[model samples]
Target chain A: TQLLEQSPQFLSIQEGENLTVYCNSSSVFSSLQWYRQEPGEGPVLLVTVVTGGEVKKLKRLTFQFGDARKDSSLHITAAQPGDTGLYLCAGVSGSGYALNFGKGTSLLVTP
Target chain B: NAGVTQTPKFRILKIGQSMTLQCAQDMNHNYMYWYRQDPGMGLKLIYYSVGAGITDKGEVPNGYNVSRSTTEDFPLRLELAAPSQTSVYFCASSYSEGREQYFGPGTRLTVT
Candidate 1:
């Protein structure tokens, strides 16, 4: 069963354009995380949100965890060519350390 | 320090063959995990270990096994390769639950 669902499986935009991607789930999570994966590379941790309704910023990227703890969103301001990659969202529930990952949103920022 | 490292960046095996995927981390983390990513399918956990000598199954563990005999090494074994097992495998480690995990480059495996 897929616990998490990400929207806009693929996106293409001009550099400097703003965009937002979403991750949603029916089950609440103790913590949520975002990862960025480049071609032929592993997914790298971008941020982790533990509190419901929490928000974090990584330079131009803004991430928010829903108050219900069942959903999250990532907004990129002025997307750049370097930001082209696969963005994934994962959630941790129960007592286990394993992560339930979403199918991911693939973004392509063109010059 | 090398956060996490995997061997044989890419591999191809014949059906019914066997192979081990190696993973090592120098951060001395207590938690390690193995995950497989299929095209457009993010990642699915195969196994995990909280510490050396302790291991557990994750969301998907069919036809796969893992062992963590040391803090720095966690190896995943496929007893019999299958076309269904073809995917990109990644190894990650973290200090503990809810912490940022460091991932290795990944092993792209194809079983024909």
Candidate 2:
């Protein structure tokens, strides 16, 4: 029973294509964070959204926090092969000490 | 600033063997954590420390032990390793609990 669920467990796209990954949960969160992990490496923080309905952008990547603070989404524009990696979303819950992570979405971008 | 550093980037352990995974952070973060990542699964927290001498179990604490004697070091110990323990282990540090965590390169453990 994953507290947070990510959709499209796997994604493969061509260069310059656009993709969006969704993370949903029933419980409200104080904040949501997005991370990217590459093979043989640990996950790196991409962005953190704290307010409901807030949108943050990092380069070609955009992160949005749901109005209810129960979900979040990450969108990548004009994907490139270098963008291939596993994306993960984590929710900050209960006084902000622990993080509950989603199953993660594996992305592969081929040129 | 080295951020977080974990030792033994790769290790192979035989069943029933025991070993310790070393983690050190240079940022002087007060909060430290241990997490394991399995294939196709999100990181599962094993243990965490709020400060020196204050340790707590997270979602997955079984088969693992941790001690935080200093602010910069948090080591994870695995006793009688099992095949199920084989996964990539990551150590993270943060200025505060529930804040953005900085991760190490990760240690890959394979148990046979």
Candidate 3:
């Protein structure tokens, strides 16, 4: 079973539309991270939420971590075609070096 | 500076063939990791090293091996490559064990 579960496996929307992706898990995590990957490249770190109930924003992207540390969300506003990519959520379990990643949400934006 | 660099951006292997994927980081980070991504799946860790001469298995360690002889390099070895091992491999480095990691562009591997 996947330790982290992401909803809306795929999304397609017009430019300027808004969308949100969810990541959930039963286990608590020390921190949660969001990453974005393009077609031929590896994932790049978007943001890391360390504290419970913390919300971070990067331009048009916003990330929120649940107070229980078992869930997180990413919201994008006025999405553009350049924003189209695969979004992944990862959780740092305990003090280990490995991260538990969710299946990921693939977003496609059209003009 | 080059945060992370992986050699052989793409490769093809026949069954029973063996090869090593080289990775190097110039960030002076102490933690390095190897992860594989399959189609429509999340990236799964294969191996990791905290420092030179130290290595550990991650979530997906089968069919793979790793060595860390120096803090700047971590290489992954695949023995008897199989079709199941075909995927995109990524190398990452981080200053701390559970912190944000910088990833390499990735290496695409195909096995026949």
Candidate 4:
């Protein structure tokens, strides 16, 4: 079973549109991270939220961690073709150094 | 800095065959990890090493083995390749615990 659940497995939107992708889990996490991966490349770290109800911004991209620490969300404003890629969410579980990853959200923005 | 490097970007193996996937990091990170990502899925950890001599299994460790003989090298070995093992393998490294992991481009393997 997947430790982290992400909604809207696939997303396709026109440029300049706004969208939000979510990651949910039953267990709380110490820190949650978001990554963006392009085809044939490794996933790049976009942001990390450690506090409950915390919010972070990377340019036009926004990330929010649920107050309960069991969920998180990534919102992109005025999406561009450059944002097309796989968005993944990962959380630190138990006391281990490994991260539990969500299946991911595949986003495609057409110009 | 060539953060992390993986060999043979693509490979094809027959069932029951065996091979090793090489991973190396130049960031001087003591922590190294191996993960596999299936089509349309997230990455699942296969194994990780804390230092030069310590290694541990992760979520999907079956049919795989790992060795960390040095701080900069961590290679994953497959004793018997299976169709179920076909996926993109990624190697990552971090400076310490709970830090951002830097990943390699990945190795796409296919078992026939």
Per DockQ, the best of the predicted structures is: 3
Candidate 3: segments with Cα more than 4 A from true spot: none
Decoy 1 TM-score against native: 0.97
Q: What C-alpha lDDT, on a 0 to 100 scale, does residue A110 get in candidate 1? A: 100
**lDDT scores of the candidates, listed in order:** 0.94, 0.93, 0.94, 0.94
Q: Give stretches of model 1 more than 4 Å off.
A: none
Question: Which residue pairs show collisions in model 4?
Answer: none
Looking at candidate 1 chain A, the ten consecutive residues that score lowest on lDDT are A92-101
* Candidate 4 chain B weakest lDDT stretch, 10 residues: B93-102
Of 2 and 4, the candidate ranking higher by DockQ: 2
- TM per prediction: 0.97, 0.98, 0.97, 0.98
Expressed as tens digits, the lDDT of each residue in A24-58 for candidate 3 is 99999989999999899988999999999999999
**lDDT measured at residue B35 in model 1 versus the true structure, 0 to 100:** 95
- For every candidate in turn, the CA RMSD to the true structure comes to 1.1, 1.0, 1.1, 1.0
Docking class of 2: medium
lDDT of 4 by residue, B2-108 (tens): 89999979999999999999999999999999999998779999999989999998989999999999999999999889999999999999998778999999999
- Chain B TM-scores, listed for every candidate in order, come to 0.99, 0.98, 0.98, 0.98
Candidate 2: where are CA atoms >4 Å away? none
User: Residue B106 of candidate 2: its Cα lDDT?
Assistant: 98
DockQ for each numbered candidate: 0.77, 0.75, 0.78, 0.73
Please state the i-RMS of candidate 3.
1.5
